[model samples]
Target: MRETVYIFLKAPVAGRVKTRLGAVVGMGRAAALFRIMTDWTIAEAQKGSWETVLAVDPPAAAHKRARFWPPRFRRVAQGPGDLGARMARIFRTAPPGPVVIIGADAPGLRARHLREAFKRLRGADAVFGPAADGGFWLIGLARRRAAPDLFDSVRWSSEHTLADTLKTLPESFDVRMLETLRDVDEAADLETAMFRGRR
Candidate 1:
């Protein structure tokens, strides 16, 4: 079986996406920025040697033929749940072989990170790409064994997000950490990403 990478994204609807950043940059601008980031993310994922999927939110977005995302890639509904529940569903349902999932909010994410995650998964039971914000930008599982409680009791957006997730894993699990990246969830984060791009 081939490896897979799922990009979790919400429909690029004004006021519905990136509400935190939207509050600072206006809803329209926030939504537009989301589109650009999603586009860049998809392009980078395509350069990898794995199956690329768009895990769309709102559930209904899965069936829409016309949307902001490109039509070439496969899509799956994120279903109804908190972030952890939705991600666990993908892990449980992905095809045989290692599975990696990432969010669109991290603009600094590149194909190299995806490549590294899959590479790390080969030796470790799991791999995590930590974000500057206390949360994680990427998570991958080798699926060599069961992991039904991997996301249990995780604090979604707080600073303890990654720490709580690590606690949920069994003691025997050998987890690898990837380079820390910044997720564009606030105006300041966006500014930093843009500034880095100009360098």
Candidate 2:
């Protein structure tokens, strides 16, 4: 079965995006950095066997397309409130198949990573690509679970994010683990990403 992959993206607005890295790299450079990474993510996910959707926020669809997205892919806004709320909103909208939600900042995320997630979802109820920082860069779900509790009562963006999410998953659900990857959240992480790429 074909899986629906949601690519959650923030508009590469200078000050609004990558603010944690902003102090070290400056917002101008932070946005530039995010732009490069987001493009890499989109291309990687587009490589094989899945349907792609770009879910963004501050909601003008066409404007998002013109700025960072390709003309062919569909787009949706993240919608009001926090990160969890926005992500839950889209999970509800995805069709009954495997639905994989991924963040925009993982420099190592690639087409094969996504393909493996979908493939693993065949036997698992959920699959997570745990980030070193304790959040997940990628999460995929099979149709049997209702994700309401999946995003609830947790810290968003903190080291506890993944731990909190694990608390909400149903024991009846099967989960698979994927290769861990790093998400670029600061200048140091950016340095690591560049260094790894050069290797």
Candidate 3:
């Protein structure tokens, strides 16, 4: 089956990206870190077999002329809506096939993780790579069936995010869970990532 991976990203502008981390590390440094992480994520995710698309926020036109992104990959504006709404749109509009979406802040994301998510989708209706902080780092839909209202009532950015999203799915939905990964959100998360790297 054709597979597509969407990497959700915000333009690396000071005071806008990684604001939580920015509060602690200064906006300039935070934006810088976000840029590095986003670059790393795209590079690693591109290693997988699926087509990689950058689902950029602030709209495509804003960054269309920007030279930051690699030309080989496709770019699309995330358009207006909440996170769930935007994600649902992608699942609904993307070419017929499995679709996986991930945030760019997770430095631990690797090609193997994405490859495994696609493999799981072969049989499961959905797959989630749970995050250590109770949210999920990755979400994928097989698209064999109509996309379900899986993101409704989700308390985004809360510890209940993943659980709330799971609760929204139909009882009959076959869901698969992947290994938990860490996503940098605050100073503590950044520290954890740095420590892990030294190991």
Top candidate (lDDT): 1
Backbone clash pairs for candidate 3 read: none
Candidate 2 to truth, TM = 0.94
- Error in Å for residue 20 of model 3: 0.8
TM-score of each: 0.97, 0.94, 0.95
lDDT of 2 by residue, 46-159 (tens): 998789988886788535547767878888887887887877787787776788999789988878988899889888889999998889999888876675587788898889
Question: Which one wins by lDDT: 2 or 3?
Answer: 3
Q: What lDDT does each candidate get? A: 0.90, 0.84, 0.87
Q: What is the C-alpha RMSD of each candidate to the true structure, in Å?
A: 1.1, 1.5, 1.6
lDDT at 119, model 2: 87
Top-TM-score candidate index: 1
lDDT of 3 by residue, 21-120 (tens): 9998999999988988888899889897799988888885435765667777788888898998889888888888999999988888889999999999
Q: Which parts of model 2 have CA positions greater than 4 angstroms off?
A: 62-65
| Candidate 3, position 36, lDDT | 87
The per-candidate count of clashes, in order, stands at 0, 1, 0
Task: After superposing candidate 3 on the true structure, give the runs of residues whose Cα lies further than 4 Å from its correct spot.
Answer: 61-63
For model 3, the local distance difference test gives: 0.87
Clashes of 3: 0
Root mean square deviation (Cα) for candidate 3: 1.6
Global Cα lDDT for candidate 2: 0.84
Q: Which run of 10 residues does model 3 get worst, by summed lDDT? A: 60-69
